[model samples]
Target: MAKRIVIEHCSGCDKHSWGTKHDEAKYSSLAMNIASDIEGEASVRNIKLEVEINPPLDRKRFVPKKSESLQHVYFDKEKKKDIRYPRLGAFEIHYVEGTSVAKVLFSKIEAHRFPSRHDVTSALERIGLYSPAKDEEEGRYMDGDDTHRSSSERSSHNEDFTAVRMDFLTKYVSPLGYEGEEEVKKMTVGPPRAPTPEPEPEPEPEAKPDEKAEEKAEEKAEEKA
Candidate 1:
């Protein structure tokens, strides 16, 4: 597969479809993106954006703009979403699309004109994705000032709301399934009598860097000799 850098799957970026630009054979466009929060723990940030490359005026580098889909997922101002590290990576509640992008159903995120930590948290919490709190504080999300944030806020024990929704997809929704092929073949009855499947032969390793260089030097020496 060809490799290409893509800023997709980044919450604040715009969605770039491979309608005509798709080059699976020559270039496998990057499907996933890298995201992180203020603490920089690779947390998912919900940025309602699509990918829009700014044609280079100088042709040196192209910067992509975060264009709006013109959607909005607002939260109650009284909810107080001024905290850091939203509960879930990004939104995973109710995808507004008539159908889901993947097999998993995700919550729709309405974009803000400018998504600050405050605005993003508000939207995330609206879809039940803000960072988790005590079970007793179900109604509340977090403090506005980010003062009471935990030292382990990066890896908080809060319920991963997005994962909870995905659990349904993995257990029953996906055709591939969580179990193996043999497990899938059997449903109610046991097939324990079946012998263990043979492991697939590994592909030959790539030529080592040092060996290649030595071979090149030997070839040169042979020509000189």
Candidate 2:
């Protein structure tokens, strides 16, 4: 857990903005941790955030895909294993130095690659990440289909690259839902972490007793006059 975290974002690096437009809060949450010590300054050329979110699962099922015209996802009767979520938490980004992120922090910190869209929420929750937005922006998370609708899937079983394929298997192939995947063992992930938000600076001290009384006496005499 980080008592204080700084995103130290770089316009030079491309991965920070993985998807979507007009959304920085989504990415800021990536840089944020559990620590409330999130107050700080950065060399950021600009700062913006997106409080976008994916909606609560409707508990839909993966029915056979219709033709291109009918390939939309809908709520059906197949029940996915009920997944327990953690207590809610806050999420945001901090601006820090680029060199600090690449050299000092990233390698030492453990990271997890979400195998599926389903896995994204779990991993984020496990790590204390939250949706910056609560209302309309909820459930707007983009998935494999959202990112790639050009090539249709023969089966919902295999799609996207290695990560997506692994995720699909975790959902369909494994008896134990996502938690019961073999790839999970191979993945060396970090423990639950919450970086502190920036700490508020300590306030300046009050004036001395003499200074306070002297100012008060002056006001009193002025009022009398």
Candidate 3:
């Protein structure tokens, strides 16, 4: 049970030629809070916050491979759960100061003793790491088979190696439709908290008129008479 979130459209950026992109929305809000002072007095205060929301990723064009073509489902040994995925191969690469090391896993590795660099690259492409247009620009093409540019020419374009495997797991291979998963926690955002009320200060005693001095003056005048 999540609280219903609300968003208001932003009009301030309409004048810019490159307005808000299709992938994102912009908003402006003037949020205020009731704050308390040291003497327990309440006052209105202004607060500033920035929030960004990413809609769900689209997978409309995603076509799962055939059962026979898919590799062994990824298994989490610590959690003792099998992650069913359609891709045949998966890999991870680590870069350190212009040097890189690749770790790949292929369930059906009958053709070779160990995975080669080309094999790892092909796997990476399947997991959405390599762009075909970019490859073509670099004198590389993917035919029906696994023939592509040399690893030396292509490796330089890939800056973040860890993102490839992470995208493969979370964006593509991640499971949908939580079946046997734990219940989702509830979130509720209620109204702002009220501040403590401080009592007003007591009024000072009013000054009394100089009645004693006037009486003394009257007695002196009577004694003179």
List model 2 lDDT by residue over 170-211, tens digit each: 433342233436544343132435887999999999866898
Clashes of each: 19, 26, 0
lDDT of 1 by residue, 88-202 (tens): 1232222222222222222213331112233333444554434444312433323222333544452332333232223223332233222333342343133557788999999
Best by TM-score: 1
- Ranked by TM-score, top first: 1, 3, 2
Measured with C-alpha atoms, the lDDT of residue 17 in candidate 3 is 38
- For candidate 2, the 10 contiguous residues with the lowest summed lDDT are 36-45
Stretches off by above 4 angstroms in model 2 are 1-97, 102-139, 142-144, 147-167, 170-179, 182-225
Candidate 3, residues 1-225, lDDT tens digits: the string is 111111112222333235422111111211000011101110111212121121121234233234543432345455565543321221112111212223222322243222223344455455444555665665553321223565455433432322233322222222322221112111111234587788888898898879999999999999999
Candidate 1 achieves a global lDDT of: 0.30
Best by lDDT: 2
- Comparing 2 with 3 on lDDT, the higher-scoring candidate is 2
Task: Write the number of the candidate with greater TM-score, choosing between 1 and 3.
Answer: 1
Task: Give the Cα RMSD of candidate 1.
Answer: 23.6
